[model samples]
Target chain A: MTEPLATGSTIGILGGGQLGRMLSVAAARLGFRTHIFEPGANPPAGDVAHAVTTAPYEDEAALRAFANACDVVTFEFENVPTAALDLIEAQVAIRPGREALRISQDRLTEKKFLESLGLQVAPFADVPDMDAMTAAVEQIGAPAILKTRRFGYDGKGQARLHKAEDAQTAFADMNGAPAILEGFVDFSHEVSVIAARSPAGDVACFDPGENVHRDGILHTTTVPARLNTSQRMDAVLMAGKILNSLDYVGVLGVELFVTSEGLVVNEIAPRVHNSGHWTQNGCTVDQFEQHIRAIVGWPLGDGSRHTDVVMENLIGADMDRVPEYANDKDVALHLYGKTETKPGRKMGHINRIVR
Target chain B: MTEPLATGSTIGILGGGQLGRMLSVAAARLGFRTHIFEPGANPPAGDVAHAVTTAPYEDEAALRAFANACDVVTFEFENVPTAALDLIEAQVAIRPGREALRISQDRLTEKKFLESLGLQVAPFADVPDMDAMTAAVEQIGAPAILKTRRFGYDGKGQARLHKAEDAQTAFADMNGAPAILEGFVDFSHEVSVIAARSPAGDVACFDPGENVHRDGILHTTTVPARLNTSQRMDAVLMAGKILNSLDYVGVLGVELFVTSEGLVVNEIAPRVHNSGHWTQNGCTVDQFEQHIRAIVGWPLGDGSRHTDVVMENLIGADMDRVPEYANDKDVALHLYGKTETKPGRKMGHINRIVR
Candidate 1:
């Protein structure tokens, strides 16, 4: 049996973005120290973490020192280089395991894995070359999205096909990388479930949050999504099924599409997702604490939402509204502490308790 | 007009205990970095703060460096040496000001100030010497407590005089320091109001929390204290009166005695108090965040409690029950990350949402 990490143990975080910043704060609340590993200088997490290593993932010496310092390791982002994980895994345990990361890292692999578990997912076909792309487009039809199998996020590395004749142009947009064509689902709304599984096999799921996207970026997430009681239950059960199937530990974000037929699995994030940011104020124990608890081999915390919350993401110029929000008694502002605010960059978010 | 501190500014905190640790976390949440100045090595606050300086308060060089590094300076404890503040204040702003510190540091001065504000206080007399002690005891009568004028906390540096004849022994316990003879009030229970005053002269007070002590240390603080409507209003009004009179620009904790006559002022802490820890989970804006906002010249947050909370301190050996608390969904455990546990030492606290 794995022993729970004692208080004062250092938790090594693989990325130092806003997720790592919030995770570091949560770890400190539970009496744990956090050490952030990020290749970029002046990471947001560096401002709050106990220690920060500004070294690339390929630096074996730095990775060794960080892994040796921590009792256990976890990543804030799923795209942590596999070589770095292989090196850190030899020294300390990595939560959600390498299998969870591998399956979720690629679009083709994630869809196939979800399908293998008898879960409903969008129809998809691999596009290995120009010939394959043409054949897949003929099968999936128009208005489908063609996305690179790896490292695609937030409308990047993806293209849309309006007709069968547009296949060649969309394939060229892939930049010669492997791609997948997914059929579009005529859904009423999008929702995501933030779930966790403990090392002891205990599962806890937060209420699904209805997501709204603007320019392919998450704009806001509102709790008590437009879901019936049966749909909510089904989403949670399906999330638990995914966690148990992967033998996963720590938090995972599962995006779903709500349709007349049923809930369809969109994708999964092995680490904490932006959609779960509402838990920070709406629940007693938030997603960050639940992630820390699971990775440290502790029992999962209560993920039940006690209040309805509307979380609005502050992207780029949205930070200008901070002073106004700060004066609003109902708004709980969380800034990422990023010095530079470029357009499309997620600067912060505010979780307002509606009820 | 004093400008509000911008995001990414450093907040310098003196005394690296649990209070400083929690304050650091709050500052981080608001996009501010914290630099902890502590006399001891390996302080609990150091685990979460961006930087730490382990130097004695008398170290002028270190104090100057810390002051230079921060945009503003504040302390978690009131007993910060005057010399250290003198050096730091010249370089940066110190919230709650020197007058508040001077008044609250001594029991005699604090009581006198409260009485001057037309607030009811326990009958007291200054005992400067052995001769004065005898005279004061005769005037104050029996069943009174003789406490040191300064540096007295948690029932320390005090002695009870049952009769006038017990004066000599009680005075001896003062260790030649200045003392105060305070007449005991016939009170039903003790409650405290955690209030904040912004630089703009706005004052906000949280609901008074009923306090229960064990062996001179705070055991638990429950919100919605046992008080009638009149008593609650009187407690809050008195707390506001003190803050406005002091021209305070930070959080202040006021302990009151609920009596038939009215609420009697016991003492005031110029910094956040243990009794106010319940605000972390019970309210959207906690005492720590309120203190930060006021000190930074920002408007105060909502001090209203959304849920009832009972905060229980984990003193010394009580740390053994952390595993049990971790498993309980209702308990929000906060450990101080102190390696050693001595008898009566506060190791951590749990804010339980009772409702």
Candidate 2:
């Protein structure tokens, strides 16, 4: 096993959004400093990070300097350019490694990997061209989603089809980008398990949290997700299977569909996930800290929940309720330090503990 | 009476110690930025603060720029030079105000102010010179402590007198600095209340925590202090009384001695105190955030703790056990990111919640 990052050593983070901002704070809690690499000027993580390299992913010189300055590197988002990671990896080790990123970066690759592990996944077909799209639509049938294989998030780059006749229009929306057609599952609700793994191969998982989405954005995640003893075990066990398969290091967010037949995988995130925010109030070790620990090679923290929590996101217009929610004694608010409040933008979140 | 700080407003902090570091993190949680003004190089707070001014307090140009950049100013240390505060106050408002500083900067003044409010404090006499020392010795008697009137911390600038004959030597130790001689209070243990107040006259107080000192520095603080329901009420009432009397904005730490007869006010810190570290893990709103909320004109947060916590300071040698303590899943460690560990220096702390 490698030595954990020394106290006061710099850990370079590849993204500077809310997840990176929180990871910086958690790194500080453990006596480590974080350096952020992002293209955007005045990124939210810049406010807390020890240093920031404001250059696009194509800036090899800047990436090299940032990598050289850090003892180890980690990314808050899985979609970071592979070429940038190649440069950083040559200078410093990147936790959660290249394989995890390579698989999760594309929907087709991720689905195939999960299926290879004997895990249940939605019926999916790759669509590289119009001919492939026609074949995929025939296999997946109607009530399916056509999503860009790369860079898809927050319900973006997606087109839903009601029948085979709509496949041509949905494929046209892809703009010639590689795509994946996935059959919709008749699941009751979605729940997610936030799991962590250390380089030493220790695994820890937080309890599943039930998720609700509105306007294609996460609205709330309530703990004590409607799962029975066996389903909870199934969710955790499946998450562990994925982490172990990848030899993963750091936190992973695995969203799953709870169906009467069994649990089917929805998607996976290689870093701290929004669905895991409830851990901040419900458990001793939140997802942010757990990720930092795993990447630094520290022992995985106990993630047992001590209380029930409901995590509500304050997106754009929802920022208006900050004052009203701030008055509630049980609510713990965490804002991202974002300056603008655009519609559907995630501004902040509050974890209200159930007394 | 004044507008609350805007979401992206900058909050200037006057020190770059652990308190400032934690305060910076707290301010970010509320979508506010922080600029730390510290004279030292590579201050611990610099790692997380949005901006840093590394010039001495006497640098008028730097102080002006720092103040001009901030919406409001607050300090982590009470003994900041008066001239620096004078310059900053002209440009921006200072929370907790000058009156609190004036009283807390001098032990004699602090004691006199306590007496003025009908609060119980140890019997004390002032010593400005040899003649005054002799008079104070006669008045306060032996088995007393002689402490400098200003800038004394961590038991420095203090001398203990076993008897009246020892007063001459203790007086010599002061080097002509103004001092206060106080008879020791016969107390079983020490407890402190971490309280907060807003400009609108809103007030809130956390439960008192029992403190243990080692080598004249805080060692550990345990919640659910040995206070009966009445004593608990007295502690909260006294803390609120102090805040209301001063019209205080921001959090204050008040230490009291638990004696059989009654509770005695030991002293008060105008800023966050080391004894209140337990609040980080035990309460929804920690003291750092509460201080920010108070200074920003936001409603006072709920300071009520949800569970029992034992906060132990990680001093110089105590850091040797970081890995050991880290292995314990029950301990939530918070390090200050300090590169060096000197004897009696605070490196970090941990809050162990009782299951």
Candidate 2, TM-score vs. the true structure?
A: 0.99
lDDT of 1 by residue, B1-355 (tens): 2899987889999999999999988888888889999999989898878899999999999999999999998999999999999999999999989999999999999988998999999999999999998889888899999999999999999899998999999999988999999999999999999999999999999999999999989999999899999899998899899999989999999999989898999999999999999998888889999999999888898878888999999998999999999999999988888888899999999999885
DockQ of each: 0.76, 0.84
Q: What value of lDDT does candidate 1 attain over all alpha carbons?
A: 0.93
Residue A250, candidate 2: C-alpha displacement in angstroms: 0.5
Candidate 2: segments with Cα more than 4 A from true spot: none
C-alpha DockQ for predicted model 1:
0.76
Stretches > 4 Å off in candidate 1: none
Best by DockQ: 2
Alpha-carbon lDDT, every model: 0.93, 0.92
